[model samples]
Target chain A: MIDLMQFTFMQRALVAASLTGAVCALIGVFVVFRGMSFIGAGISHASFGGVALGFVLNINPLYTAIGFCVLVAWLIGWVTEIGRLREDAAVGIFFASTMAMGVLLVSLIKGYQIDLFGYIFGNVLAISRNDLIAMAVLALLVFLVIFFFYKEFLLLTFDAEMAAVTGLPVKWLNFLMLTLMAFTIVLSIKAVGIVLVSALLVIPAASAVQLTAHFKKAIIYAVFIGVVSCWSGLFLSAFLNIASGATIVLTATAVFFICTFLSPQRRKMRRRIGTLVKTQNS
Target chain B: MTTPVIDLQNVSVAYQDKIVLQDITLSVSPGAFLGILGPNGSGKTTLLRTMLGLTDPFDGTVRVFGKEPKKLKRLREKIGYVPQQSHIDLTFPIQVKDVVLLGRAYKMGLGKRPHNQDREAVEEALELVHMTDFADEQFGRLSGGQRQRVLIARALALQPDLLMLDEPTAALDVGAAESFYEWLHNTHKNLGLTLVLVTHDVGVVSRYVTAIACLNKRLVAHGLPENVLTEEGLQAMYGCDAVFFHHGKVPHLVVSTRDPEKT
Candidate 1:
């Protein structure tokens, strides 16, 4: 592992892994809390279209993906707010259409289908210094926005109607949150790929929720689980020459299962049931 | 003499092409304990949303705090609102204290953290609702009535001049509902805050509220509970003959269904 760190590519991959893990999990807390896991899944998959568009236009795919993801996020918000369609329905529509577009664009490319696969499955070892910088900037931006609007976001997540009644600009705040979620998904694609990014966005948060009953503590636990899973998964993948993205996601899932098994609420319920049985027998 | 705190003049609200409320007019004076009674799908929730500025009336005008609903930014801070308890997600991981603290988010301003005053306000609200002991407990772990009380504490943390509740006692048991109304009545009497409650329970409206408005797609009657909770008033609101009775001085409206064969 020390020898692996000596390589510049491995160092860059480590930085990318940690950054994506922390940022994705932070945003994931809100997504999980608000029951918007489908939105995360939709946005990550939608980025494939942006990636294809970038390749077709002969520009950086990350830039194109960013623009495309933001556009899709805004569109989802608009459709839901219009009240003609439900949020999940809008998400489902965009998710399928964008993926379809991506498939069409990819077929148009004559050669190097392997490049597209790299984006789809992720190649952590291929992370460049520029990618690391972009990830860092995005991570910083996401953290700053969350920090500034922490209270408002908490209120919106807990009770959106109450937030609106309290004059919190609920609609705009929702759009901003979705936009930030898009950025997080886009920045994380290189680490976990589009197919597995939603896992990074949801699993750690779900695991953290089982361990804590407070939102702030849940976020802290989620970030911890996210960073640890990514670090350990990256190490194991490098040692075994396995798929890093899948390994990271599996590691997070493992954490979620462990948390579920040890959840205090579950234990309390079991204890109450045990007491009831004992009382009935007596 | 004084202008009404909430004034809706010939207001009509619609979702898309379907009209939910049609040409309804109401004016609530300061310190009035107004109860809005209507059956399910009778636009009770829509009326509260209109006053909160969450919905725009398709016709006529709405004024909250003597100004247009859209221009109530500063005035909004002075209005505390508690939506129905069913709207809250009980499974979400949140503590009672944090939930109450959310009430001060707008007042804390953008980018500023909660200060000592905000904490004090949260504590005071919890005490007011008699939930100070449960402040650190998980909000999801509480029973329905307890959760309702916590939600009320959250709204109270806003320290508003008007407190609006929509079907606050809908999920509570009979005993719990009775106590909830008693608590609300005491709170109104002590705080001297204007109160507007939307509920389907005629008993609650007759027992606790000073003024009553009955709505069924439109305003059926509006005045004192004694005047508006009569058999004639209820027939106009419910579209059916209702028998009015008093149980221990509490008024109750029982809808009478006539058999077609007998008619």
Candidate 2:
């Protein structure tokens, strides 16, 4: 175990994975609560187009991915607000088109297929010092925004109409949330790749929600689950020679299933069903 | 005259080319319990939205607290709004106390948590709604009636001068609806708060509201409930004759039906 930390790549991987996990899970809580899980999935896939474009244009994929993700986030927000289409429908439209572009761009690439594959499937061991810096900066920004606007976000997620009537800038805050989500997804692409990034965004938050009835508690639990799964999954992957992203997602899913069985809400539901059965028999 | 809490003059609202409200004029005085009655798609919600500054009128001026509706940020502090209960996701993992405490968001501003005064306000609101015992419980675990009361309590925590509700009793049973109205009446009387309710139930307006505004894309009638709730007024608003009767002190309306044989 100590020998693993001796490797600089392993040390970088650990730091990057933990930061990505924490930030993605924090944003994930809002996603799950507001029923924007599809948006998360959409934005993450949209980043693939950016990555492929970067490869073709010989630019840093992360930067291009950030730009692409932000554009898609704004598009989703705008379409949903215009009331011409449902949010899920907007998400679906972006999801398919962006991925289609990404596949087309990837096919056009002459070489560096291996490098592109790293972003598509994620290679935690390949995380550079600059990538760690980007993740740190983004994670800091994300945390600060959430800290300052915690109450506002809570109210918006709970009752957006009430928030708007109370003079909160509901539309701007919505765009801000989506933008933050896009940045978080872009940052996590190094740890989980484009395809698996949404799992990190949703699974920890979903698991946390099952365990708690309060928003604050749910957030704490989500961050905890995210960090734990990241660290454990990284170590497990390194030891077992498996994929880090898949391991982390599987770990988070396992926690979610366990929480589903042990949650108070689940017990109450079971009791409700038991009484219904008994009443019918009587 | 004392400044009206809400005053809308010749306000017309449109979504794209479709006009939802046309040349509607109304005023809500302080301490007035005004119920707005309208048929489906008759702009009752658009009226509420215009008053709250959530929607811009295509024409005419809207005032809340004697100022332009959009420029009433300070005035908004004195206003509490409870949206339709159906809009809320009940299973969204929020505690009752937290839900009520959201009323303090504007007061707290950015980066500020709920202080002692905010907590006290929440507690008082919970007590007013008779939900003090369930303050720590999950909001989703409560019954439909209880959830409605909790939503009201959330608004009450704002210590608002005017409380507005949009179809609050839609999801409630008869007993719960009565109790909710009773609670509103007491709160209005005791707190001296103006209450604006948008509803389709004629009984609610006829029984509890001090003033009634019948609207169908426009203001059909605006007066005391007994005067505004006549068969002719209801017919004009609902596009059909409706029978009005009183069960005890509460007035009810039943849509009229004509049989071919009778005709």
Candidate 3:
């Protein structure tokens, strides 16, 4: 463990893990509160399609992933807003179709894709300096937008109609929200891998909500949980020589279960049940 | 005479083939506690939304504070609106104070945090709703009646000239519902604010509101409570021979013979 710092890849991996964990959790707070978990799932899967397209075009997969994911995210937003179909049902259609596109696009490449597996099951230790820089830049962009429009996002999630009534540009803001989610996915996708990206986006926030009544605190706790589990998972995966993405997600999932047990809401329900039992006995 | 707070002229709203509201011409004067009385799906909510410019009217103009609602965006700042079903996202992680602080978002503008005045406004609004003690509690942890009060406080924190409430007590029990009306009555009297409440309780409308507008896709009657609460007005709005006679403890609409239940 002492010699771990000597390895530059370990240093880069730790930094990438921290960046991916915190940013994904930040956006995850809104995604979870909005109950748009499926949207995140759909966007992340669409990112896989982007990567496959990038491989076929012989270009940076990151750029194509951004293009593909943002378009799909906006399309899902439009479908939900138009009231033509239920939100999950619309996202479900995109979720399955995009993955199929990704599968088809990957097959179009004549030879085995060398870098494909890196994205599917992420290799954080393999992160280069440029990848770290890209992750940092994207994380900063997500932070700036959320900082400026924090109030608007809060109101939109709490009650969109009320936000619209208060003269806020609800439609444009909604687009901006989808765009942010896309950027966040692109930011962390390379390091966390495609499959574990949505889990990172959802789990920490889910755990945070169980413990706190305050939204701000939930964000804080989510980031805290995210960073800790990310660092530990990276360390444990290295020591045991296991899959890093799966280890991190399992660690976070375990934390979520623990949070549920300690949740104040659960305690209240327990008290109610205890009284019910007493009444029945009497 | 003072100018009216809200004025509409021959407004019609449609969703594809269905007409939600039609040919509605109504004006509400200042200091008027008006009740929009109608059954479910009778355009009571649509009429309210039209006045707020949430839904566009296919014909005629909807003016609030003497200007078109869509044109005068600032009109929203002067209007406090508590929308229907205030208990949205009960499990959303938010404190009651933060929920109330959202009402002050317009004044705070973009990228700015709440200053002293903003905090004071939140405190004042919570105090007005009598939920000051629960300011730090989770909004989801509160009872249904308490949640409604907190939502009302959120609207009141805006410090608007006109107030609108849609089915404020729809989810509340009888005891809580009565208290909600009493609180609204006091708020109207003390603030002297123009209030438009959408409700279907004919008896409560007669007892509390100064004026009434009965709607059944179209405006059936619009006048003083005494004039609009008659049997003819009731029948026109509800599409049945509903008599306002005393059968139970409280006087309510009793449907007699020849009743046609419309879906």
Scored by TM-score, the top model is 1
Ranking by DockQ: 1, 2, 3
CA-lDDT, candidates in order: 0.89, 0.89, 0.87
What would the per-residue lDDT of candidate 1 be over residues B38-112, giving only the tens digit for each residue? 888999999999988888998999998889876887678888888887767888888999999988888888668
Cα lDDT for residue B32, candidate 3: 95
Per-residue lDDT over A115-232 for candidate 1, one digit per residue giving the tens place of the 0 to 100 score: 7777798877788787788888889999999999999999899998888877788888999999999999888888889999999999999999998888899999999999999988
Q: Give the per-residue lDDT of model 3 (tens digit) for A26-126.
A: 98999998888888888888799999999989888887898898999999889987867888988898888998999999999998776888888788888
DockQ for candidate 2, C-alpha atoms: 0.79
Q: So what's the TM-score on candidate 3?
A: 0.94
Write down the TM-score of every candidate.
Answer: 0.96, 0.93, 0.94
| Candidates ranked, most accurate by TM-score first | 1, 3, 2
Output the lDDT of residue B79, model 1. 89
Candidate 1 Cα misplacement greater than 4 A, ranges:
A280-282, B248-250, B253-255, B260-263
CAPRI grade of model 1: high
- Which tens-of-lDDT digit does each residue in A64-96 have in candidate 2? 998999999999999987868999999999999
Error of 2 at A275 (Å): 7.5
Model 3 spans > 4 angstroms off: A271-282, B246-263
- Cα lDDT of model 1 overall? 0.89
